[model samples]
Target: MAVNLAHFALNADDIPTSRAFYEKVFGWSFVPWGPPGFYHIRTGAEDAPVQGALQQRRELIAGRRTIAPECTFTVEDVEATARAVVAAGGRILMDRFTISGVGHLIFFEDPAGNAIGAMQSDADAE
Candidate 1:
């Protein structure tokens, strides 16, 4: 199966500042969701709008932090994809985990050291 960019999340130190900037500059809308400091971003695109979120910044893995937007790829099976990632010289940073209403997810770093996520959709993941 071909994996696709399913979502992207922006990590911010200051939610209000980042949210306001996106709202004013990009005309994006934010809806509070999930945890206290997390929000769903609406980009107002006419076509198939890509899923996006803004959340508080934290370590991507242990003491290492990610400064760029975290991108998530949708796949049929996260475990299989994770195996392929490792086979292709990538390193798994996190094991598989459920995201309640979202799906099964795994975090990994590419050979180039870019941290990303792979998700397998399942509304009943909770």
Candidate 2:
């Protein structure tokens, strides 16, 4: 039941523009994701696993756009972790939600206001 850093996501006002910037500046490459506005970012070789994604700002919940470079952590149980977050004086910014074929996730703010996310794998949830 250990929690681990899972993924990082960047919020962008314009996905194509952001992707181009990262590609030129950092040598990153991107592939379109499920929807029109999302793209998976590849920082290295094509065979290397994608480390993060560039998501359109409008796709995220309100107030979340202000926090770019959001870090998501994998947890044993997102619901339990969310409860613990509240008990520990943190605030839940987004309630538990599921991503089809992926997993359940929740967003929360640390006491100091840093935004973070927790995810529970779909396999584990089942």
Candidate 3:
């Protein structure tokens, strides 16, 4: 049941502009993800290097301003962990869903209202 910090995502009203800014400022490269309007960010080449993503603000939460960057943690079992989240008093904002080749993901808010993501990779599920 070892959970590891997996990725981070930044919500942007304008995907291209925000992507350009990060590319220029941080020199990060991006690859198109499975879903349209989502891009996977590459920050470094280290083993288990922390990765990130740029997503449309509207895609994140409806009628809410973008807050802090969202952090995604990798879990061994998304469904079990999602249940654990509710048992621990956290609220699930998004239910488990597959990302094609990526994996399964769920979004939830902690007791303090901070948004977080959980991912269970396809490889790990097998």
- Pick by lDDT: which candidate is best? 1
- Model 2 local distance difference test score: 0.81
**Could you arrange the candidates by TM-score from highest to lowest?**
1, 3, 2
What's the CA RMSD for each of the models?
1.3, 2.8, 2.3
Q: Write the per-residue lDDT of candidate 3 for residues 1-126, one digit (tens) a residue.
A: 778889888888888999999999999988997578899898877676668989877534556665679899999889999999999999898999887667999998889877889999895432
Measured against the true structure, the TM-scores of the candidates, in listed sequence, are 0.93, 0.82, 0.84
lDDT at position 10, candidate 1: 98
The better-scoring model by TM-score among 1 and 2 is 1
lDDT of 2 by residue, 1-126 (tens): 677777788888877788889999988888898787888887755585646888877424454455568889999889899999999999898899888777999998898778888988795442
What is the lDDT for 90 in model 2?
A: 91
What does candidate 1's lDDT look like per residue over 63-114, in tens digits?
7777899999999999999999999999999899999988999999898889
lDDT of each: 0.92, 0.81, 0.85
Better of 2 and 3 by TM-score: 3
lDDT of 1: 0.92
